[model samples]
Target: MQDIENKSAPTLDQILSLEKQVWTALVEGNAQADRALLTPDFLGVYPSGFANRDDHVGQFADAPTMKEYELSDIRLRVLSADVVLLSYRADYLRPDTETWEAMLISSLWERRHDVWINSFSQDTPLDQV
Candidate 1:
């Protein structure tokens, strides 16, 4: 990963675009697309604990669906030339629920072989007021 440090980093717009693509894949339960965006050793930390790449993909097995979602207050921190940390708030409605749930999401992306893929992620649910 350090080898790419000398390479030009991706613009914030490009990173956000990839983030949106990831959200779209999850919302649509598109395992293939999700897999493509995640590294083989990717780990996801959710309220339920840690999930590996397969576990994350298997989450959609029952089609845990979302009716709609919006991302807000997105910001990016460049950890290194080859790594980036993306933080954002996600508000979404479940297909079976009328209320919207919010979560703070942080994802770590690494540039490998000139392509960026998500290496890690964590989701913290926000308490409702």
Candidate 2:
């Protein structure tokens, strides 16, 4: 049974690769790339509050907000044939800062016109201790 489940499970490599593109956009401050990866009505929930696709892209207006990042503990769930939920822990450094911060993120990716686009995301900051 376990072997059957394993064999039937969907591969996550493609989703992980797509998620990496988003992180790369943040590190490179590429607003166009970021916008391209997200849906026009994308919604983001963060510690700072709610944000839309434009708000997410606006962070790159001046410069890159992230300097570097590492993602781990990745997991993916298929919500439907065209939708998936990707969750992971991210340790990242902000631009001009040496301190690293950690957060858990869940992003929903939906296939639109045969292309995967991020539709929703929620970020939870790790407790500082």
- Please give each candidate's TM-score: 0.92, 0.91
Residue-wise C-alpha lDDT for candidate 2, range 1-129, written one tens digit per residue: 333323332358988998999999999999999999999999999999999999999999999989999999999999876789999999999988899999999999988877889999999999867
Scored against the true structure, residue 61 in model 1 reaches a CA lDDT of: 84
Tens-place lDDT per residue, model 1, 1-129, is: 465336876778888899888888778978888889999999999999999999887867887566689999999998887899999999999878889999999999999978999999999999999
Off by over 4 Å in 1: 1-5
lDDT for 64 (candidate 1): 50
Error of 2 at 9 (Å): 9.0
Best by lDDT: 2
- Can you give the lDDT of residue 110 in candidate 1? 91
Root mean square deviation (Cα) for candidate 2: 5.3
Error of 1 at 88 (Å): 0.7
Q: For model 1, what is the error of residue 81's alpha carbon versus the real structure, in angstroms, after optimal superposition?
A: 1.3
